[model samples]
Target: MQADNVTRTFEDPMLLQRIPSAFLISAAVLVGMEVIGFLLLCEKHVYEITGFSVSESTWGEANEVPSKINDECAENAVMSNKEMTPLEALQTADFYLLWASVCCILVPQTMLSSLSKFFGLEYIRDDSFLAGITMASSVCNAVGRVIWGLLGDYLSFKVPLCCLLLVWTILLVTFPHLSGFEGSHLKALYSLWVCLMFFCLSGVFVFTPLASNALYGSRNMTINFGLVYSAFIIGGILAAVLTRIPQLHGQTFTQFTIGGMFCCVAFVLCLWLKDPKYPNKLKNLDVFFWFREYISLRCFHWSLGRYFRQCS
Candidate 1:
């Protein structure tokens, strides 16, 4: 779904423009967080939200499990870990962790790229429902790539990222309120919301691994991307911690709050970012426009460097 050629072109300016250029990868990560958060808001999306909502809604009231804190989960009165045999407990815990991992990583990386495609299968959510949204997402995704790519080319990466983050902020924070609407209005709102969600996700096009190089610096291409990719796993691990709190169990609010907060952090971090200089983009917009940007404060021989120098 992400294009390397396009990413390469914008990498220079993106790295130069600290706001959006820096958020390129962060946007992808935040989107994953967004999906996790959105899922938390909908009971239909997560079987775990029931427990989380109950727990968070009544913070004082203990929900079945009493010792509800990280690492201390075994101390809880209900379903105490002491009851299980070492092997049985380990197996159960392993499965729980594995499933949590799937929920975390899959929702962001795969769901955005492929789930809708699968939803298109006849046996899935009634070919009628999935077909429309899935097809629309794919079509819009293709169109957005060009539009966003060009924007990254001419304008600052800040424009696209801030707008996307702002929209994402609304999406993450207000998603819960949407449920208040009734009937076809609710469905229509949800449909439109989903489209907007996809729109923000297009930020990934600008922030792909190819783009990461220009923003961070191409000198350490392999290492930078390697570290960035690790974020997915790390984010997944954090998701587990956020979702499986003993009290909240698996609530939509847990994920949503976490995602909302993460998005804010990404946005803030982007404020300090700068764009990389790649004059080639102007000359060969056809070629470099679609290429990736490898970024680093040191790499930008442009405005971003001047800002860093002044800050120091």
Candidate 2:
């Protein structure tokens, strides 16, 4: 009788319930964690704590470099308080310039990272050493984000962005020659180059959002940053296309040289970028005007260096 009953239950069409048991458990866990987070995490306003908004703070005061504040104050003041709608930001030339710069900057990072192992095997044959190089590169990548972010805050975003691109350009162009070093020297140099490349590349992730925020206001930063970040799509496509080029295939020097050229283009774009505060500085795409301004800025930096040398 028991066996017959068991057989009848097994044969029953509706014996098993179509319950969403897994979905219910997952939903419950997600809700519980979210509730806990909501209760634990509290938002704090900088204005409430410091009795002043960040926009009201002067760069001179923040960085304690007041000597040149007079020259920069007007520009800084406008940039600090400037707010733009996402649509307005999208319509601006600065937006497209930044997008193009990011597109070019991403090329080396995408290509090098994808080809790291393959490239490293040409010099260092050991798989374990290559793995260590990757691990070291990752550590530098994390540390660099913080360092670059702080540097941007101190010196402004443009200077650091340009410097980072310049360094990456040099690294990419010269990286293929590391194979000349024999034995341990090759491995060490290769690792150093890879780590430094990663460190410099990390700034892109930090600076892009900060630049977007500085340009478009914090209120709609999400959308503005998202628009800027779309450059990665183009960058990835370019990297893929470059890798598939017949002349570039198995030609490390040519490949790196091409990547370096792209990086140099990004650096120039950064130079041409007008300060958000001084949008009227160069109107009608004035190349001569831009060149004059750049030269003057370089001279000013040189003068400052001389002054500091004399003081010391």
Candidate 3:
């Protein structure tokens, strides 16, 4: 009888009509919350918050700064007005390199996160304690994003990103070896490792967008960022494939070592990555140009051989 009633509920087109009062109540609650939010959270101008008044004369006076000073400030500022179109950015070597680095760095975090619960259970026998550890890692994830974003703001994105990835690599590589402690020591170390992994993982999210904005410019930021973010799909697929490896099953050391290797590659890529605003002499020595030239030479040789054969 219960199964028949469940089937009727699934098949009934008028099920919503029967629950119209519940639906209406939920909708009303949502509308009320939205109304309250709108009232409390409306946007305000800086002047409104600071109680500053700007007269026409004050505005005119502000614009009277010397052109020479403006030029000097523009030269000194780290922010660049120069921007590229999405197509133009796509053509650059930095774009693909950044994408690859993002993919490599993301794999370690994604794989560890998916297997963390299982790994934790191996060290900490209590399911409830492991759940709490997971919750703490979640909190660390949120906090780390804000902290790392601020660090990026102060140091520029690349430096902080490199540092984070370096530390994350070390942590991943050493995590398995460090799990040999007993009792409370085991739980504490396990929780700390999980939380720190999550914390370091947050920097990838913060720095990627910041780096994209800095390198690619804000002109087509959304599209360019979407292209970069597509690396996560690749990373996720790679992580899933790694997890399914029969040898890696229950083998913590081998699994994390592989993950660490990916992060190490990401670190090397980060080292190679250049700041567009302050490009160095090494910019001309990129692998991309070398590969392009190599291909061009191969094409030239093939064409020359074809011409000689035609003459013969």
Task: Tell me which of candidates 1 and 2 scores higher on lDDT.
Answer: 2
User: Among these predicted structures, which one has the highest TM-score?
Assistant: 3
Give the 10-residue window scoring lowest on summed lDDT in candidate 2. 1-10
Give a tens-digit lDDT track for model 3, residues 162-204: 7888999999998887677888888888888889999999889
- Please, what are the lDDT tens digits per residue for candidate 1 over residues 9-109? 22455445776665798789989999999878944554454544445657666563454544322222222112323234234322233223223332343
RMSD vs true structure, all candidates: 27.2, 15.6, 10.0
Return model 2's CA RMSD, one decimal: 15.6
lDDT string, candidate 2, 1-312, tens digits:
011222322333343343456578879999999999999998885663555556546754777765556655566666667788889998886798899999998788777786665677655667678778888998999999999988877665776887899999999999988878889988888988999999998998998888888778888899999999999999989899999989777788888888889999998887776555433332444463378577879999999999999999
lDDT score, candidate 3: 0.79
Top candidate by lDDT: 2
In candidate 3, residue 222 scores what lDDT?
96
What local lDDT score does residue 250 receive in model 3, on the 0 to 100 scale? 76
Please report how far candidate 2 places residue 134 from its true position, in Å: 0.6
Which clashing pairs does model 2 show?
none
